[model samples]
Target: MGRRPRQGPPRPPAAPADIQLASDPQPDLEHEQTVEAAAYYDVDLTNRLAERVEFFQCRFKKATLAGSHLAKVRFTDCLVETSDLSNLRAEKGTLERVKLSDCRMTGLAWSDGLISDATFTDCKIDLTNWRFARFDVVTFEDCNLSGADFTDADLRGASFTGCDLSGAQFHNAKMAGTRFRTCELEGVGGIANWEGAIVHPDDLLGLSYVLAGALGIVVRETDR
Candidate 1:
């Protein structure tokens, strides 16, 4: 008998039980007065701003940072897991070698930031904004990024695998050597905005729909 086709890679284990939010509450920035290297777990940090802060090897587990702003900050080797950062902003910041796993960051904005060698695994980044940011050698694996925006960003050597990017916008973005593997791109904007984008041939199938609209041609499939 022929060997069966192997299933896809095993999904990562779910986050810890304590990582779940008990209630949807706003995060309190006043409580985060200190910048020490301690564990920040199960805290609500919504609508807060942390400027000129530095977090060295800190762990932010199961915390909520909704509508928070973090500017001129640096997170070195941090582990951010199961955090909810919806509508959060991180501008003019640096995140080097950080791991953001199993986080819910819908509508999060990360403009004018530097994220080098960072990994985002199994995260929900729907409608997130990455305008004018710089990402060098970043990897996004098994993430949901529907309607996310990458306008005017520098995405050199970035890879997206098994991600959903429906209706995502990439207007005026510099996407040199970017790869998308097994990802969905339905209704994504900025089709003619590929100044220096390099996509896989299989992914170009999705672009055909956009190109057809640009060239004012109708595509009709025939029954085989």
Candidate 2:
């Protein structure tokens, strides 16, 4: 068995697998609503209002979560495949042991969340708002994370593999134990904050200009 995701607290047991997906959003969702062990395919969760809900061991394939509002929600051991999460607003949520593959997460507002053991593979996560979030042992593989905001976030032990991080913001982000493998760092922000992070030698060459700027050095063409 693989290692478990870094979780803060233990959640309650999930329901049976035969649980049905919610067709309509609950007008007033209360505390600790559990939505686990279910599968939803090609459904629409637009304009939903869910708070403090738990989505455990659930799979959402080809679903649209446009304009959904989920605050302080918990998503553990869930798989979200080929889904449209554009304009989804989630704040202070918990995501552990979740795999979001082939998903469109543009303009997602997921600030101040706890993300661990999560893999965002083959996902379009451009312009996602993850500022002040805590990422522990998460991997972003084969994903387009352009313009994603990780400012002031804790990204220790996170891995970025084969991902396009162009124009991504990393201002003041904790970089200890962070690894970037075959990843694009074109125009990535906050170069001074990436001292402890690991990167390839070729990738470092690509960051020369940024590094020079961070060190207040001018790189001028020397006439031979």
Candidate 3:
């Protein structure tokens, strides 16, 4: 006999204060000196060196970090939601098991950085450079990555699902076991430099133009 279909769990009720605005406008960087597992909201941190800073189970919401250098910093079990990390440089920084949701990170460079089990959802990362960075088990879902550069980066087991990669460059990148599923490759360049990238067969449709351009051949349609 066949088994019955399983039912999912019931949904929770919506909160009443979902549309309420703050009265006093939350202060930025209230606990800059203190290092604790707390929520950091509405902060603007720039040109600061945060070394060996461990953010364990902390929340960084709507924060803006510009021109800051973070080295040996670890974001373990932390949530960075709706934050702007533009022009932020991170070298040898580690992001282990961190979640970055709905963040806008333009011009962000993470050279020689290490990212493991990091998840990026609905993030807009334009002009972001990740040269010589090592990424393992990283997932990028529904991210807008226009003009992003990943030159000479090591992307092992990195998955990009439903991401917009228009104008993104991946020159000389070592992408072993990299999966790009349902990604838009309009105007995306540097496909010839992918040494060992493992792309999905269905996603190979996006490389039609790139293959034709590489072989110097024109694809013309024939009408019946």
- Candidate lDDT values, in order: 0.74, 0.81, 0.71
Q: Which regions of candidate 1 fall more than 4 Å away from where they truly are? A: 1-36, 221-224
Candidate 1 per-residue lDDT, tens place, 114-220, comes to: 87768899999998878888877788999999998888877665778889988888887766566787788888777777655666678889877877876778889
In model 2, the worst 10-residue window by lDDT is 1-10
| TM-score for each model | 0.79, 0.86, 0.77
Candidate 2 per-residue lDDT over residues 1-224, each given as its tens digit: 13233433223334345756656532334567887686778777777787888887887898887788989888888888999999888899988878888999999988999987778889999999999998877888899999999998888758888999989999998886688888888788988888678887767776777777778888889899
Better of 1 and 3 by TM-score: 1
User: Which tens-of-lDDT digit does each residue in 1-224 have in candidate 3?
Assistant: 12221222211212222222222343333322334456667766666676666666667789777777766566676678999888887766777778888998888887778777788899988888877777777888999888888777776557788998888877777665677888887666677865556676877877778767777877789788
Error of 2 at 171 (Å): 0.9
Rank candidates, TM-score, best first: 2, 1, 3
Model 1 error, position 207 (Å):
2.6
Ranking by lDDT: 2, 1, 3
TM-score for predicted model 2 compared with the true structure: 0.86
True lDDT of residue 46, candidate 2: 76
